[model samples]
Target: MERSFTVDVFKVVAAQLIVWHHFSAYGPMSEAMTLQWPQLIEWLYRYARLAVQVFLVVGGFLAAQSVMNKPMTHPVIHIFNRYLRLVPIYIFALSLISLVVAILRTDIHADWLPSAPTFSHFLAHALLVHDLFDIEALSSGAWYVAIDFQLFVVLVVLCNRLQPYGVRVLSLGVALLCVASMWWFNRIDELDIWAIYFFAAYGLGVLAAWAKRSAFDAAVFWITVLLAVGALWIEYRTRLSLALITAVWLTIKPKSRVHWTPMKRVVHRLANSAYVLFLTHFGVIVVFSALWNIGHFHDPVTAFALTGFAWGCAVGLGLFLHEKAEIPVHHWLSHQSKLMFLRLTN
Candidate 1:
């Protein structure tokens, strides 16, 4: 089946928001704007984090849909292909960070990368099992990748028994379970143990996939969208719970299209770079901040401008890496995995 252009646009938008979230974390804007724009900027930061939830939902939906539609006979090969798809870019990003640390000789601590990545650490990261044993994030963004892997495993097990209607039921069940889990964890203060409540976001994605494949109803879709907007507003007014509910509903609804000439094309291209940009953009930001002493940008406007410039550089670097490194590596690893699977089976 052809990819959904609408979902593709949504994914790109979500990815940009993810970058914005990270920029807020690493940039001086948040600290600088605290006094002058406390409520507005802080609210923006919260909303930006919500964008990652959207990405997770889309990923789950697309992944479940792909597996359900194409039903892989060789599950091992499928698993291997998935791992291979992510590892090259991950390793490249890790290497880039290592180079940064070496060049700058900065004493700043990184939770993801150890003082020195030993053989075991390398193996653990390469195998994508770093998070299972409580390994810290080497890069601030790696937590999502670990969560994606875990979600994939969960989907694979569920997909084995999923039928047409089964998908819908399972998706809804997972979403509820996630909300319950989050509530329980929060009550106990164990929320930090799970590393950002990824399972919930992933469940929403699965729900989205089921919604898409089920009968398309215009009223149902609009209702879900309205509820999502309302939920987001409620989240802004009260707490974070409503946002998740609305996100689940939105995932299952088709997004409305807005016609724009050049901006749409630009968004599409940036969306393609979402993964690469997410992985590599941090290195760009770190380098720029170090060189410019961006921490000194005490004014919100100046800090925001510097953050934007840093983001642009990161996007440019990501684009270059996507064309030169990411795409080629993905092709090579995919082809190599196929060849190995054929050899092993034949």
Candidate 2:
């Protein structure tokens, strides 16, 4: 199946939504703005996290594409490569976040953002095990990156082990895992630190990819959807519904094109750099919020307007960090990781 144009557009929208949600959520300004737009703030706080499900489904779809073309003969090496790709930029973001948190520790106090960091806390982030350790996350939405990595490893392992049997077997196993998540695992938020809780959304992406296959059995697709829906019905979850909808939409196999027009290129660029945006955005917000504190505006509207400006600055910084730092760091680290993997395995 050709990649869908929806993926690119969704990335851009979701990135903005998540960032805005954070913007309206964390700072003292967020509190002041709430008096003016309570309903809007309330709505964003409730629904914005669901945007993650959209990315989950898309990630699942793209992950299936990654492993479907070839068996993962070196799942270990593939996992190492995945970690290398993620960790370089991740470490950079974490360092910046740590510095921001240290500098602003006395200036701001938001309930959700990270506090003063310690050595062990930093280690947990470096290892992507902050969630597992129940450590306060250093940056907004960082846990998702760790979970995304784990989920990909799970998929790679499953496909590599089942490729001998066939795609059908792999699809069935994945669907069953999703059902388990929606029904049992997701019910327990504590388990969310693991990837199992999010698997339903992620697995739907894989299922959607298989559903598009020429050889896919129709039963596989419908059964997966049915079990997952029934689980949601038994215990309705709005977030699950968002993911369910995203997965169903992907199954449509929407039209996509690469016109490479200026606008289209911009969309494609944002889509590709969305992760960098996600990773680096929080520090931007913290830094801007610190600067925001220096002024005392008589009107909260001016404060809110400046909040909008801060949002723009955050997006711009994320883009610059991706192009200048993330790309170069990943290229070097991943190349070295591959060479080291070959030397060790050879």
Candidate 3:
């Protein structure tokens, strides 16, 4: 499937919001910014994390595109591919975070900074089970990566079982799961560590994809709309509202091109850089927090400048990792996964 410019725009916007959210929510820089722009910082601190719902919905859309209408012949391989896709960048980010924490822990008495990690702590994060294990997350948004992987596995397994039965049956099964998730699991805060809690938003995206495939008949799309409406009627959730808007917009948005070549290239690059930015930005935050503590700049202007500088550094590092590390590593892993799959099949 070709990439959707509309979805890319959503990804870029969400990733940037998450970065700003973290910037405003943590560190001495956030503290300084709070002094200058208390209202802005307060809003970001309170609301910015909701951008994660955008990702959950988008991920479901793309995952459904990959497997829903077809047989999931290699469910294990699909699951493994997802783990490979998520974990390398995650481990890379965790390494950077651990290094920053090690260098700064003694000097920084900040509550936001995590203490030095034990081997088990690092192992839990690398396995993407830190939250389930009740271990402290080394960085913000770490749980999302783990949750995304779990959601994909669930989708793949369900589709693998019901896909041979036909698209209608498969669609019905997925919709039933979404209903279960929305009506029951989503309301329970304690279940947040599990994918079922967020599956409603993710399933909204899946239903949207299935609906888009059958555009000749609008029935599927209407079902999606009604499902969302019912979920909202039961209880109004801002995150689910955002997910509904995103899924609906992505479904109906015209497939238009950016005729301007330079702008097109820039958009593509930013879209591709979104995941890397999410992974790497926290490490930038950790280093910036350490520096801010050492310098102890109290003035709002200086604080504002330093904060802006750190934000730029995070973007630069993200773009660098996307181009230099993420792409090449993904390519290499793709090749490795193909070889492993061949061996298993043969």
Candidate 4:
């Protein structure tokens, strides 16, 4: 599997944007910064979250690639595999967040801090159904993890169920769902927690992957664009616009090989750690916010410095988590998965 530098670049950029978005959206530091740099903080708080659309499209593109390029496995096993890949590191981050929140709760009181965890909340998060159960998330951006899992499962099952019908049928099935998502489901804000609301963006990624492989006419891509345009025309959404742009870029982007330069190395590293960064950075922000509350560092200059330090620490922690925890756990779980599949086969 060849790497896509563009996708790596997108991942790195989107991840950092979300990180900054969080930094701006949460805590005393953000408040202090807002006093000094209101416009900048406002822009970050308001717009940076749309970066998640970039991730949704990228995730769909990758999921499509896996479905098309790799040998098909049992649907159940494949779904389980996805869970294994996501959960170990997720659990680690969740545990860390719970501890941080618990510690912070005793001394610091803020609306931004997640409330104390319950057995049910922990259970729901562990099962990746917290959002569906209407449980308060233990950390910022936790909803996305659950949504990602749901979206992946939906894609896999959709692909599997349609397999016997031929490629055109499968594509049509996916296309119809995408249309429903873009035109109808996505318009209803209350449905955001579910995969249906985001499937349009994910479906665009699937379409992009298929278009790149010539599994469907390039016209299919154009048609999707038209659908997206119509959806936007009906009601404007910046998030959907971002997703549309991402899908178009992905479908038509040049396939020039990315050389392994020093910069590319850094980008790839950040990209690989992006998920961990998403999972863990909020906890770092909470800590920084707590420190600000205790130290009374309300001055903008000092607040800005600490905010930057928090960002650096979050990145460093993400890198360490990825290398020390995620990668090893992924490998072990993958090995176990292969054995389970073999046993099932024999």
Model 2's lDDT to the true fold? 0.81
**What lDDT score is found at residue 227 in candidate 4?**
88
Task: Give the winner by lDDT: 1 or 3.
Answer: 3
Q: Can you list the residue pairs that collide in candidate 2?
A: none
lDDT (0 to 1) per candidate: 0.62, 0.81, 0.84, 0.89
lDDT of 4 at 305: 95
**What are the per-model numbers of colliding residue pairs?**
4, 0, 0, 0
lDDT of 2 at 10: 81
Native-vs-model 3 lDDT? Answer: 0.84
Estimate the TM-score of every prediction.
0.76, 0.94, 0.95, 0.97
lDDT of 4 by residue, 1-346 (tens): 5789999999999999999999998888898999999999999999998999999999998888888744344688888989998888998899999899888875568876788788988899999999887888988878999899999999888878887777666777778898899999999999999999999899998888788666463567678789889999999989999999999999789888888999999999999999999999999998888888888777999999999999999999999999999999999989988998899899
Q: For residues 1-346, write the lDDT of model 2, one tens digit per residue.
A: 4545678888888888898888777876777778888888888877886798888888888888777768778788778778888887888888888888788766666566677788998788878899887888888878988999989988988888887798778888888888889899888988887888899889988888778675464467668788878988899988788888888887775545646678877887788778988888788778767766655543568658878888777777777888898888888887788788779889
Question: Which is better, 1 or 2, measured by TM-score?
Answer: 2
Question: Candidate 1 has which clashing residue pairs, if any?
Answer: 57-205, 112-137, 112-138, 113-138
Comparing 1 with 4 on lDDT, the higher-scoring candidate is: 4
Candidate achieving higher TM-score, 1 or 4: 4
Error of 1 at 64 (Å): 1.7
- Which ranges of candidate 2 are over 4 A from the true structure? 1-3, 109-113, 215-218
Model 4: lDDT of residue 250: 91
